[model samples]
Target: MLLFDQNGWDSRTYLGGWTTLGATADAVSPSTGERLGSFAVATAADVETAVDLAVSAQKTWAATSPEEKAAVLRKAAALLEGTTEVLATWLADEAGSAHGKAAFEAGLVASEFHLAAATAMMPYGQLLRTGRPRTSLARRVPVGVVGVISPFNFPAILAARSIAPALALGNAVVLKPDPRTTVAGGLYLAAILEEAGLPPGVLNVVPGGADVGAALVDEPRVPVISFTGSTPAGRAIGARAGELLKRAHLELGGNNALVVLEDADVEAAASAGAWGSFLHQGQICMTTGRHLVHESLYDRYVELLAEKASRLSAGPPASGAPLGPIIDAGQRDKVHSIVTRSVDAGARVLAGGSYDALFYSPTVLADVAPGQAAFEEEIFGPVASVTSFSTTEELVQLVNSSPYGLSLGILAGDAYAAFELADRMRSGIVHINDQTVDDEAQAPFGGVGASGTGVRFGGHEANIEAFTETQWVTIQGSIATYPF
Candidate 1:
């Protein structure tokens, strides 16, 4: 059965099942400015109710057998794989993702579910050595309920990464997806899991604005918070979570760097750079925000990058354009402002620095320096700022200068040299011959500094750590006599 249908958009936000709140908001298509449908607008009270229900359901879910949990997750994965095209269409219509990016995200959601299913079957504890005549072991247990706040970009993947693992590990989740992408990010997952035999209250979707998110973070019932969004918002969540003595897994913003060594092929390097910067209109957190090329090939690299940027046209994803519209006019204006300010600061726009409505042209800026806005800040747009470096030390300095250290990429003829360079870089993820915008379901994905709490998501180990708590238990034949 289809998890989502156009007619199902009404009362899309699922607290336990498809239900409506006191208020509702329209889910508008960013690419066409058409109303897809309305979704429930969850209030602070709604968030509290969702968390309360999750807490009640988590106990029974935690008592379930690992095999049963695994079976449910695997079924969910199969369902997602079967309906990839349907979800991809939602992604394109709701989040303005290009067809290719939308399809990739749809596939990624299924992959995440598959990975979580495997995690459910993995060993949950380890035996410990003890000196006394006692059996001691450490076992993993659920963290009660997890509060997940996900962004619009790669909505399904980001939310599914945290949600699937948490549920597989027997913890219920109360997810708050960005209001702009409620259908794809929130309701879609809820629908699939419910159909796949997920019990009521095990996964809750409450789509709303900032107030709703703050309520989820502040709820005392939620002992863990998994947030993916801007750096500023992450900082606030981290601080509040700390005040509540709760664990927070934050995957925040990034101004990732792509370094082209002197020996690198200029054409290949340019291709990687363009893909990293322009894919999904650079809405990705791991987008290549800065390009640091060696002085020898810098001019040619810039020229090729400019040509690539100029060739890409921004329009609706249905138009078969490689680049899609910005999420809204406000975001388009923010991107254009950064480009204009960078140009004002002496950086030349080599190809594009323009927009029509919400569609922004893929822009390339050359001679971007340390102090320039485009180079220093995380531009969540299809804008590539190129700079030249003469030495390894200079390249390292350039890469580390940014406040964000999410992802780094190095392209060089010598793999050993690239590895050594990666060692010196401060980023959480490094690619030797690839771009910054990349991820795998099995990799430990996160960043340091403003990017996120380091290594908090992905892989079996990280997922277990993020969603479960370790408890030490001792066993004996009977109650032993103890001196009191």
Candidate 2:
């Protein structure tokens, strides 16, 4: 079956099944400045109703056999793989993804479903040793219901990373996707899973603004909240979830670094740096925001990077451009403000410092220092800030200065030296020879410090820990007498 259509585009939010209540909002194409379609805008009451249904559905779903759960997940994966073209189109129009990025994201989402299906058949728990004559064991159980809040940058992969595993492990999910990407992030999954034989109420999609997100977090029925967004918003959700005594898995923002040692090849390093900073318009959490090079090679490195950046053009993904528009005008303005402030702070834009409509050009800034806006802040745009470091101590200090530590990358001629430098880094993920923008369906993905809570979101072990609870049970053949 086809994944999307005109009718599905106009459908309401998925609560148990598709239904509308009250107001609706339009999903506009960020690249084209045209209305894609309208979806039901869920209110606080809709979030409450969705969570209640999830709670009710979790009881039956948790008791389902592992084989049955795996079958459904595998079917979902097959369905996703079959409709990659359609899904990519939705991603391009809604999330402003380039054609290649959109296709890669669709493929990754399908792979996550396959990995989650494998998790269903894996070992759940272990047996424990006991001194007394009794049987003892620890088994995994579902967390009942999970609340997922995904961002627009990576609408498909981010939402599917949590939702697929949560469902495969028998926990129902209530997802609130960003209004900007409601169809690709929220309703598309609902439609695919529904067609793949998933039971009603097992997965609910609500598309709305911050009010809907607050309602999802405040709902007592939701014990787990999985959020992927900005650092400020994550801190607010983490604090509120703590007050409610709930588990909040936050994958927040990052200002990652890419370091080039003196012995490294400036030409090759420049290419890697460009890919890290310009991929997906540099909107990813692990995007390389800071480029640190040895003082001897800084000028040449900056020149090559500027030349590379100038070759890239931004426009609608349908126009086959390498770089696409930012998510919206507000985001485009934020990018421009950061670049402008950095220029005023003595940083020079070597390549691009201009924008037209929603499309911002790939920009390279030189002479950026520790205190500059481009160097310190997480500029979620196609902007690369280049700085020079004199010694190893300065390099260490420069990389660790940022409060956000999501991913780090180092390039050098000597492998041992690069490994030594990587040991001093504080980020959760590190790369020795490659840039920082990377993710795998089976790898543990998250960050430390201001980036997020250390709890990760992928792999077999991490997924089990994130979505399930462990229970200890003991049994005896006969009833024993007890004194009261």
| Per-residue error (Å), model 1, residue 345 | 0.7
lDDT, candidate 1, 330-427, per-residue tens: 78888999999999999999998998888999999999998989998888999999999998899889998888989999999997889987988899
Per-residue lDDT tens digits of candidate 2, residues 20-57? 86988898999888898889999898888998899889
Candidate 2 TM-score versus the reference? 0.98
Clashing residue pair totals per candidate (backbone < 3 A)? 0, 0
Query: Per-residue error at 260 for model 2, in Å?
Result: 0.6
lDDT over C-alpha atoms for residue 112 of model 2: 94
* Lowest lDDT block of 10, candidate 2: 1-10
Candidate 2 off by > 4 Å: 482-484
User: What is candidate 1's CA lDDT for residue 86?
Assistant: 87
